[model samples]
Target: MCISNPNSISDQTDLVAMKARLWALLRKEEHEWLQKSRLKWFKEGDINMKFFHLTASSRAKRNQISKLKEIPVKRLSVGSRRLLERLFSEEEVWNMSCRLCLIEDSSFNNSFISLIPKIDEAVSPEDYRPLSLVGSLNKIVSRVMARRMASCLKEVVGENQFAFIVGKQIVDCVLIANEVIDDLSKKKKKL
Candidate 1:
């Protein structure tokens, strides 16, 4: 007579449910191998808090172990001087967008001052004013150009890159445009 393990069916079902839940939870932020390895580790009872903490620390020390492999090629550096330089080049490429928008130098200056208020306050007024203007205008122009560049970029880099660029550009443009619009509205109110 052959005897079946009484717990086998229930164990399998529980495992499936646990895997589904983990996958659902980490779907947005997990790479394929990380997901698979995590599920396997979990089945082996290696993902409890103490074990997980140790694993995470060990993983962090390793050079090639990435939880999310789909991270962008370019690091998103905020307020870097190199970022400013890239913005400058982006603006030059989007000269047509600037021409179409008719954004003035003075308005650009004011916008830049408002955009990076922390940075502006740190610098002397004379030095800050010109730098702020150029930075702000470049940002605005880059944004406008980004929209036009999206289709071309999408063709080359695929949808994700295009989406990322367009999303950032839209946010930047909307912020500047809203500020300008609000000022105009206030002026009209005074008049």
Candidate 2:
């Protein structure tokens, strides 16, 4: 129905206001649903309104704290705090670092062996390959040692040795051998 009087202007304004309120309520509802979905670990792009409502209600029920108990608080004294600070001083930490040795202990040097299937269907033991997963401490220690050794590698290693040296590959020896062979074949020279 069309209002043809002065009330038409006021009716248009009221309609705009109602539209804005409706949009605001819709946005608020969407935001609440999104939060509930996240709490239930639901991913986007899925239309699961029933699941979202169920999870939201279940979460609301679970989150309600029924107990009302007063917990006793324990405060540490100044002298005890000072003693703890003294016990964990920089000097004590340095001493501990210097004494950090786990070479003799097999427990600390323990590594896990994981069997990975070599074929699609591994029926026999030979079909599976064993991979050693070393401890993080061992990897860190070895990497540190390797980095330290790498700095002095060039000075210690000779020019003829190509493998394990920086910017040199074992294939370089094969190339050099091939060149020598080609030169000998062309000139018919003695070794």
Off by over 4 Å in 2: 1-111, 189-191
- State the C-alpha lDDT per candidate: 0.59, 0.70
| Model 1 ranges with Cα > 4 A deviation | 1-136, 157-191
Residue-wise lDDT of candidate 2 within 1-191, one digit each (tens)?
35466468888887788889999999999999999978666553246777768878899999999888996545545654444344334564444335554353556557899999999989999999999988645665555455445655655566778977978999999999999999989887553
CA shift at 51, candidate 2, in angstroms?
89
- In Å, residue 54's CA in model 1 sits off its true spot by 12
How many residue pairs in model 2 have overlapping backbones?
0
**How high is each candidate's TM-score?**
0.22, 0.39
- Could you tell me which 10 consecutive residues in candidate 1 have the lowest summed lDDT? 74-83
lDDT of 1 by residue, 1-191 (tens): 22255478876777778888888878756677788887878875464677777877787788565476575454323443234444445555567545656545656534433333346346555443243445555666666556545434433454433235545554666778899999999999999
